[model samples]
Target: MIDEKGILFVLSGPSGVGKGTVRKSLFDRATDLKYSISMTTRSIREGEKEGTDYFYKTKQEFEDLIKKNRLLEYAEYVGNYYGTPRDYVEETLDHGKDVFLEIEVQGALQVKENFPQGVFIFLFPPSLEELKNRIINRGTESEELVKNRLIAAKTEIEMMDAYDYVVVNDEIETAVQKIQSIVQSEHCKRERVAKQYKKALEADFS
Candidate 1:
């Protein structure tokens, strides 16, 4: 049997849009899928690790990587630089492991431009009201921050059409299933299957 090639899966959404939750579920259910850990200049949180959660780096170190063009997509957010490292993602794909990147809208767009074949999915809440409730329910941010996020969510929703697929995460299980189905469908694309068949035919002829 021929080995399968990996794909880059980009997942993007606004804060409190359940992107993290859905991504966790997809990771739990999909063993072959690998999550990309980003590199950030922000201080590590209480329980986060350096390499696992994020490659914690100083401002100078991150700037050096940027200068060397080592990052796939990077941005300075809230006084900290966060970015995805290119080597790890490319290595994972070379090993036939599908890499999933849970990134912001800007990063997702950058990835799409860098890797035209990448699959991009935008997860959205069922409605604005539900999004507000979800943000409040999380209880991690202050009321003012929640309000600001709501405004940002509205703006982000406008970019949904840029993604290849929009998944409304109204229900967790259903949303997870939909994402899984999308991945499965992508693996069946004619281009990928045709490449496999052509390789097999060449081997047989040889």
Candidate 2:
């Protein structure tokens, strides 16, 4: 909410949810939106680009960033460290471009503390059973890991009230449209336009 800066739109949810897919569709439709790339200590997988996919860093480097308060939020997941660097988001926002972040619930909460005015959107799966199926279908995790994620999803969903908005991902298109509308609405807030109003009034007085 800095003067003339852009909104820090945070998208967060448990694993296997379609947060990434929905985020992609949103930016595809709204090309003006900027994506915040995350930094990770995890090894790069096949077909993943350095900046586009993630800013892969060593554990020591990531820890140094944390020590310097350069990272907005960070957490270890499945033995890999991941975090959102504050500089990129702030720089893009200062340029008057909205930046989007896809993070987990834990990391999102941290952002909430640092950027209270940020737009927090929670993406929900159609159902827990379907969520489990989606994770299993990914074929990345074992049966036990899938079960653990499902258990965690339930707890995460219960905290949905903590977010500014929640969209049920029954259909990706519908979800994207709803989020798009939310952005449009946020841009219309009176406080967001106060600077323009003040400038106009000053000109009249002059």
Candidate 3:
């Protein structure tokens, strides 16, 4: 068999663009890709489990990891820290398993810088009005924070040029299907498959 390193797929977009929802739905049906678990200093909720929901850590521990350059990207939110662990992602990729990350725009950009070959996808809302409504409907954000989020969303949407694919989150099922199709197409890309094919040919000749 031809040995191949796995691909890193980063899915990110505006805050209220349904990145998490689409990701969860995609994983519900697809089994080949492994989810990249993030480390966080946030307290685990009742329904959450360690190593599954998030790799919980203390603030100092998280700071130590940051100092050691163990995280690909990190951010502070609501007085808690959250970040993607570099070691886990690298090990998973090296083992020939595709790794998926669903994150925010800033974190996604950091991953792109670290892994330039990663498949970066930008999720988009059908409209700014719809996005605003989604965030407001959550009822978790204060009115001021909601306004700030909309402003941030506009800026994030402008960064769509950086991504390899753009999928509109009009319908959950449709968005999931499009993302799956993108992954399939990426796998078939000549640049990704050629190396393995060449190795297979070399082995056959030998």
Candidate 4:
């Protein structure tokens, strides 16, 4: 079999758009793609495992990584730092296993600049009003924080043009279905599959 490099699929959107939820649901079912774990300075939450949820780091450690350019993209949100490690992603793709990155808008943009070939998908809320409700419903953020998130979400939504596809998060199952379909379609693109076929043809001639 021809070994082709794997695709990087980035899932990002406004703060309250359910990117994480959708990603979890997609992975819960059978799939071949690997999840690219992010590193964070924030304290691990309940039920979250180290390396699985995030590679937890101290502020100083995270800053050192920044200095060394070990991270593909990093962002400071609220009071914590979050980023994707460059080595793991590159190595995984080289091994022909697809990678899925569920990240925030800023991080996603940074990844796009570094890896333009990635499939960027923007997960959108059904409505701005619904987005607001979702953020508020979390009960973890202050009223002021909720307002700030909504503002940020509005700006991020405006940047949807930067993405290759938009999947509305009105329903988790529907969004997952659409995203799955997109990944399947991307793999079938002639430009991608043709390379392997061309190699096979050359081998036949040899």
**TM-score: which is higher, 2 or 3?**
3
lDDT of 2 by residue, 8-69 (tens): 98888877898989988887883677889999999999999998989999999999999998
TM-score of every candidate: 0.86, 0.83, 0.88, 0.85
Error of 3 at 46 (Å): 5.7
Q: Candidate 2: where are CA atoms >4 Å away?
A: 1-3, 41-53, 56-58, 77-80, 140-145
- The all-Cα superposition gives candidate 2 an RMSD in Å to the true structure of 3.1
Clashes of each: 0, 0, 0, 0
Worst 10 residues of 3 by lDDT: 1-10
Per-candidate local distance difference test: 0.87, 0.87, 0.91, 0.92
lDDT of 4 by residue, 70-89 (tens): 88799898999989988788
Of candidates 4 and 1, the better by TM-score: 1
Query: What shift in Å separates residue 39 of candidate 1 from its native position after superposition?
Result: 1.3
Clashing pairs in 2: none
Candidate 3 per-residue C-alpha lDDT over 1-206 given as tens digits, one digit per residue, 9 for 90 to 100:
65778888999999989998999999999469999999999999999999898999999999999999889899999999999999899999999899999988999998888778899999999998999999999887898999999999999999899999999999999999988888788878998789889888998999
Give the 10-residue window scoring lowest on summed lDDT in candidate 2.
1-10
Best model number under lDDT = 4
Best by TM-score: 3
